[model samples]
Target: MLPDADAVSRAAADLIGSAVRAGATTLGVATGSSPLGTYAELGRRVAAGGLSLAGCDAYLLDEYVGLGADHPQAYRCVIRRELVRRTDLGDGHVHGPHGDADDLDAEARRFEEEVRRARIGVQVLGIGSNGHLGFNEPGSPLDSLTRVVELTERTRADNARFFDRPEDVPRRVLTQGLGTILRAERLVLLALGERKADALAAALTGPVNPDCPASVLQCHPDVHVLADPGAARGLLDSPRRR
Candidate 1:
């Protein structure tokens, strides 16, 4: 486990940089607090001429449904502000499911086709305190594909911090499901803070079940987990409480 969040971010960045240098063309990126440091490090590397993501195609892991284009909390807007604007990846190279679509099911199909065409090389993820990856909350099917899902109250509550009020958070989302995310050549799951400790432990060592959706990563051939001490406490048997 890493000493702190910064170290975990650097480790994740180093791996991503190596992947890019080795000619990985597609990247799947995650939003939220977990990946902020990693994206910042990537932006710094680009600014220093040490790295470039110019031609890399970026796919967002998920998006909230019904948010307007100008909504600050919209996943697409968040991605542009947090990563794309800070790096060499052009806006055209970044894609996310159309959460505002008139027909959500058709949008999900279109997103699946787009991702299938691009073939994601590496996917970055964050384990929810409820053991979710992307928006695949508890009880999501193991073989689920890109689809729209009702947001669990727990998931909505956790995300409330990003909005002005708890009720302002969207009630549904379009997310790359367990099956779709598993198609990536590699997975990097990042977790930080004591709040994520229990989930991280379940994802790393518990049964590969839909109840703890992230646990399915155990079956993946190439999965990298980067967590700070606080988040790793459960696995390490530390005295830190979650």
Candidate 2:
């Protein structure tokens, strides 16, 4: 039952279109290689005669602490290059954690409030090979909200692809916790490639545990996991999709 990347992107576009039609003003997004295709497709739709993000408000999922907002690999910069700058969404509507904030906790609280007020209509997520969601590594509580977190070695390694050198990746990050992400009315979790198969299967069938933080999605009211055949190998073999 696993879908290819194109299927996932089309499904995401359909969700975005529905939200636009319903007058949704805000969207929560994740930044990573897994989401690149969806963003690209969305950008294409805007480029063609499909949809526009003119009045949309976008909230990013996480930001590495200590990285300058303008840092090329920073989530802000990535979002700008990949999605925001390419869309009609006004510059003022794009929101992400302030990595330079003097009071990190206060900043996290403010972000939580903004999300609450915006009432995000759709949230896009990328799964870590270790099953984390938005930097909420294993053991993160399902009810957690925005907070500062120490990046796990595995996560840092996985994210190193975006940095000039592996060591350049940040050791810490500020992320909207599982609770914050689940607040969105709809959620789309995208995964691709064989590298993600084990984690995806664990999330879909294994017991919900902090070790596999993304497993919390099982409790979400409206969550759709979209994975390519390579990533869905085990799940397809399971009795569920059958």
Leading candidate by TM-score: 1
lDDT of 1: 0.92
Q: Candidate 1: list runs displaced more than 4 Å.
A: 238-242
Model 2, 1-242: lDDT tens digits are 44578887887777876787788878998999988878888888888968988879899999989988888888888888889877777767789889879999999999989888889888999898999999999889989999999988988899888888999999988999988988999888898888888888888888777788888888888888888899899687765421
Deviation in Å, model 2, residue 126 alpha carbon: 0.6
Question: TM-score of the candidate numbered 2?
Answer: 0.95
Q: For each candidate in turn, give its C-alpha RMSD to the true structure in angstroms.
A: 2.5, 1.9
lDDT of 1 by residue, 107-194 (tens): 9999998998889989999999999999999999998999999999998999999999999999999999899999999999999999
Using lDDT, give the best candidate's number: 1
For each candidate, give its TM-score against the true structure. Answer: 0.97, 0.95
lDDT of 2: 0.86
Model 1, residue pairs in steric clash: none
